[model samples]
Target chain A: MNYRDPQLCELLAGQYVLGTLSARARRRFEGLLPGRPDLRRQVAAWEHRLPEVLGQAPAEEPPAAVWNSLNRRLFAEAATTPASAPRGLFERLGFWRGWAFTSSLLASVFALALLLGRETEIPGYVTTLASMKTRTPMWVVSASPEMDRLYVRALLPMDVPHENGCLLWIKPEGSDQYYLLGSIPEHDGADKMLKIDRKMRPMLKGELYVTVEPVAKGMPEKPAVAPSFAGNWVPIKI
Target chain B: MSSTPEVLGDLLARCALADRAAFEKLYRLSSPQLFGIVLRIVRDRDIAADVLQETYVKIWHRAGDFRADLATPITWMGSIARNQAIDTLRRAEHRITQADDVDEMYDLADDSEGPQDAAARERDAAALHRCLEELQGAQRTAVRLAWFRGMTHEELAEHLDTPLGTVKSWLRRGLLRLKTCLEGA
Candidate 1:
């Protein structure tokens, strides 16, 4: 049916005023009202008639932030409209300003690297952890004999996904057996310390080795995952 | 006689003439009220802001065509704001299914008024206000549910759990009574 029909126009107008018209119909009505005074009058009449309802409804105060932003936009439009008027939003540098985009990207990359890297340091003992591939120092290890404890820290460059925990491995120099110490605190960019005793007596001169393994939660405690952190523990002779 | 709509009609004409001051004044006066109306319909502050901006842009562009013989300036702008908001709602896939039944609840529908009502309406704001007060409970409900809630006739029917025809009649009759009340006053 043609929206031109008087009845249809009025019905649509009323619904438009009432807001019951579907979005499509409402848009059509707006387009029609400009060209058709009859339709516009019909809508205005409904609006005037409903003053009681609108009046009864409490007025809501909009946020000051909106007003502030609107003022800024209007001022900018007033000031630069001659020069900036031709430029759309993307063309303006202000739209791209600030740290929002770069900050989030940097955060995600850092997390991914920290979670994936495997390496460890044991301070105060002659410990060395090997790279999973080369058995080379993933981290430089140094320890004082007086400390009576081992600290393993990973210094890998890329982020690691650590929704799963990490594993720490230790084997005294000249020993082939790898003893599991425990897991590193996940995703924390701090020195991860592991306890040790001289009774394990594993460290000869520069004999202790520590390796990092990334492990999933609830995995059996028997073995480690990929070796992330490894370094030779060098003793500080006093 | 100058009414609020007539005053706004004049402002819109000035706005059409590229009167930046008039446009600014119009924006200051109308945006908050329109924002509130749009916010109620869209229920999201961000989306409502987007619709509000579009509505004002249309008003600024089309202010010249505004006629006292047609709609009050506020009502015309309201139409733009409401239509944009509803369009947004539709694009978001928020439309209702067939379970709606607006028929049985609003049986007393009518739509007799036309453009001629404008002159008479301008003369009697008080009478219109009174007649609105006199609208039956269902009529008031039907109109409010339609206008503010942005529900369709079928949606209103489903919402009120009434038949489609009745809801339509309630809206029609309610609007007619409201028009008569406004015109008589």
Candidate 2:
């Protein structure tokens, strides 16, 4: 294997990307990569060229659990306190979600609740939190009073502002306060599971909102922005 | 979410700054195609999932290393995925169990798309498809199987039932031609 020969390097690099290189040969090739920009360029060229040969392989979405597993392993800390950046209008809104939100979120919640009222009672309180602006479901939130588990599942990755983070809060029935459940699952952390504090179990019947708040360590005074997505528990008999 | 180079490049720039939102959006938009490619090479859902995780972790960290001057976003990212998948396959080569279930091996492309599918891909993909069509038939399938299955030289020799020497000769010729055709295009 002459590492100096452009022809041999191209052959090895091409097969490496095509994956036909034997393990020993591939290792030898890689050992040569960092020191040899020519080899690296050749390898990158083959890497760029070959996959396109297949044109497009149909996209198969990985099993949903993979995303959750990634969040746990990769972005755990960021979830706890998304980066604390400059405070904007996000930190000023406080726990206030009423009056301003009742018009849209409440109206949709009433409609969905009636839609679910006809179904049998299961143990879980499920809500599909849709964007208030676009009316597209962004997060499917579920709280189980029986199991004391809270799950926030993102339907699609939602974008959080650079200086802000999205948090899940439940406004328990007849209560003026919006209790923080946990950070809402974003594309990075798609399937987040939060434990429903023992005292918060009774609030399962209330409204669910995925709200935007300034990036702060731990819980904030409350969400400073109105609910980006809001819904009520659509009970499922599971 | 579209993966235009500009969009993915912007996402990569943000990811370098530790922007979780951009990283998430990048994963959401790009994972499917990368996963599809990996699932073909690794051939096991569990291992493929593991490989996909490793690939993205590398991407999140390596986003800073990406050179727009070198490759398109998918190519750069796709190469990471294929490298991860192939590495897993080769490292566990002696596992000798699931790897033997050749009957379960996917076709040339896991999800079979036809000529129109080739046309639908971006210019690079389409050009490669055309260049591939020009290769000798044996070399064409040989390279495709090597790519899709991540087969080693010995495995290719055995799988194709050709002599090891002949497979190497033909494969090298095939690869050389592919490079020439692609570069010329």
Candidate 3:
């Protein structure tokens, strides 16, 4: 198709923005959008012109959860930790390795408790981590009630290089601060347990986020890259 | 709608810097109108909420790419919401099976105010309403149905009880007139 033809582009762009183009045609137009600035301009023109139609719709307030969710996602880290600090205990490999061994043992006990339906005293919380973009669950993150330890199990294999690893972050409730909990091993499908610092335990009641960063340099105080997966650490009900 | 172009542009610039407060301000200033637009197209409250969420996420990430010279922030964001709604509608199994279904597709622009009052409120909106009024009645209906219903040419022809070729002609002529009128405005 002569997508560059001004007449055709205008026609298609109008229909595209108006939502009248067929699904197949719409995809074709969108595929053309990235490379063609003129096509994009045409689409924008149509968009600017159409809102009078939209302005006619009666406005309704969105439910409060929308703001709460957005607030939790964007500001949780700013409330607890200075954005540039690197003092988190999770940045140390030796501490992480020791905790990994202990966390595995704890996870086994926790699993056994679940299987036997027996009561346990380790107040714990668990959440399924999912991609922000796709909303597909990728991992499960669990924390002991005392908020001193975390267990992360991979539900899907991730692609992390030997020199690179995944880091977990916690954002305490009612605060904008984000704390670096520590790094997970580079193994794609392996489960790793982490020890949360005693000082940071009180801040673990908020949300959990995981990001892939260079392990050789140590985990940064803040995620240098976008989080790979994230979820809230809801308390476990007996 | 109370936010001026300058306010929205400033908020968008701050959002590009990962300013959480600015993002919240932008959402509060713009979301009700954008949500209304999405609800109009998707016609499902839950789906509209999801689409609105995704739309804001995109707005947050793409804030740096926004150019004030190209379009107003609301226009750019509204386009994102509308396109997402159209995609969601297309993916679902529900399809308009009868001509009567098209009538329920959109609520007409509230006509409580006369044209003069509307024009005085917002120049751009007034200009658009005026230009749209210039088209022949059939052309206007065809264009509105095509837009508000997201109908294909065949679907539009079926809904309007007109020949496929005639519907195409009306839409083509209507769009050309709209482009000329909007640009001239």
TM-score of chain B of each: 0.69, 0.81, 0.79
Reference-based TM-score of each model: 0.47, 0.56, 0.55
lDDT of 3: 0.68
Residue-by-residue lDDT tens digits, candidate 1, B42-93:
7677777877776776676556445555555666787677767777876785
- TM-score order of candidates, best first? 2, 3, 1
Residue A196 Cα positional deviation in candidate 2, in Å, after optimal superposition:
38
I-RMSD for candidate 3? 9.8
Across all models, the iRMS values in order are: 20.1, 10.1, 9.8
**lDDT per residue (tens digit) for residues A1-238 in model 2:** 4678878777888888887776677666766664577877887777666766644455789988777887777787455764333223232221122223334434444443454457522335566676543345666655544738766656576667776778888777667788888786678336666887788787766766778877666677677876666666655553
DockQ-wise, the better of 1 and 3 is 3
The list of candidate 1 runs beyond 4 A from truth reads A2-9, A27-35, A52-57, A64-238, B1-11, B19-21, B93-130
Model 1: per-residue lDDT, tens digit, A1-238? 6977777677677667777766566555666654576776777777655533333122345555555565566556756763232124343222232123234323433443343235422223433343332222333333335545445444343345655555555554455566665565433335555565666434533223333334554534445443444433433332
Q: Compose the digit string of candidate 3's lDDT tens values, residues B1-185.
A: 34666667767765654556668889998888778777766677877787788788767756655767778777777787777777777788345454544334444543343212345446666776778888888888887776665567887788788999999889888888988887776
Worst 10 residues of 2 chain A by lDDT: A89-98
